[model samples]
Target: MSKTNQVKEDTKSVFQNKGSRRNFLKYSGAGIATAGILLMGCEDNENMVPDLDGVVNLGSGDVGVLNYAYVLEQLEAAFYINVVTNLYRNISDVERTMMEDLRNHEVAHRDFLKAALGSNAIGELTFDFSSVNFNNRESVLATAKVFEDLGVAAYNGAGKLLQNPDFLLIAGKIVSVEARHAAAIRSILDSDPKSFAGNDVIDANGLDRAFEPAMVLNAASTFILNKINASQLPTS
Candidate 1:
């Protein structure tokens, strides 16, 4: 009857609904390949790959940022799903429940962005987390902190690139949720509720840090395998 239980039930329902072969193909692009191919032909391909330095590629304006966010969410969603599936060492029931919730949240965000972007969204990325020790608590939490912080910074950075107010509004809502996720992850790791509330993200004026899409994309390229085109984004 609790909110968490409700969320769990909803997630289960979603999985069940999509678990069928027909539904899976329907949502997973088997039915949309022709449409996707047509869209790709007209889409801008210049920004698909990162810049010459291989750090930043702003693709093209608002869509590019959305794709960037999509990529990060894909990473987070994949990581959390792996965690839930593997059940790493010393993980408690509470941790497992909370992580499942996080997994569902990430999946929702990922799907939302993919849907909103339509054909503009980047292709599915190949992630390399070999550096992360999934069985170790320290490794997992540390990686989570990095991801959450980066996600918050990414949304903050891309605000200016968004020409549509609706997109900006959606980004605001999602980033706030990401901040909460960051706070919770920090609390779990260090027992400090405010560990993630420092000047790095929050400034001396009590404002969150904002970077341009170029900068955030540059930072993110290290973790993601697929290159991003951030050149279409504003530099200043």
Candidate 2:
């Protein structure tokens, strides 16, 4: 197999073992609660249905919050998958491993949300990273930082909107992972440890910033090809 293919296989294995263990640990306490989510996903409820009229309405209530997260995971997963497949120039061994790990983790997140959402999940989203210079290490890492930070904020903001305790618990777990990814990317860009939790994203109280669904979606719109409607999402 080619080197790229070999890398893909290695990452897949890592995800199966390491990623599974990590997510399992985070989810273990909420197993029964998560199972409830799966049951909810299986149901064909009128309120949970999105109008497919050329736009994806993220549905409503807890399902809406989930689909919102699903969209972000899909974007992050796609970006890292591309970065791994088409490695940047002069990439180091450590960087390559980091990329692979990030890719697999995002994929695992995307797939888990998809499975949890079941039929209630939105269709696959299409992304446009044409502007990203995948061949350049700086460009790739910068974009990664953007995606990771955005993912962390999106989850933080949406957590309050979820009424289901199980869903909120899972979202909190996922956001913690996303924050780690953000910090990793930040550290890579600037060896300064402070950059990992810079003042830009963290307040004086040392709390991470959160962006509401609309704000998050707006920031992410530059790369997304599909028009998403979050109007039906819960307000309070």
The residue-by-residue lDDT of candidate 1 on 1-236, one tens digit each, is 96545533433333243464344223322333332332233346564553565444436766677777888889899888877887679898888877877787787778766765665666677777778888988898888888888888888877777775656766887888788888788778886566768655687888777766667656766767766655565544
CA deviation > 4 Å runs, candidate 2: 1-44
- Location of the lowest summed lDDT over 10 successive residues in candidate 1: 30-39
Predicted model with the maximum lDDT: 2
The residue ranges of model 1 lying beyond 4 angstroms of the native Cα positions read 1-58
Candidate 2 backbone collisions, by pair: none
Superposition error at 69 for model 2 (Å) = 0.3
TM per prediction: 0.74, 0.84
For residues 1-236, what per-residue lDDT tens digits would candidate 2 score against the true structure? 96545533432332233555565434322232244343264345564655677798788888888889989999999999999999999999999989988987787788777766767888999999999999999899999999999998889889889886756767777888899999999998988889999999999998999899999999999999999999989987
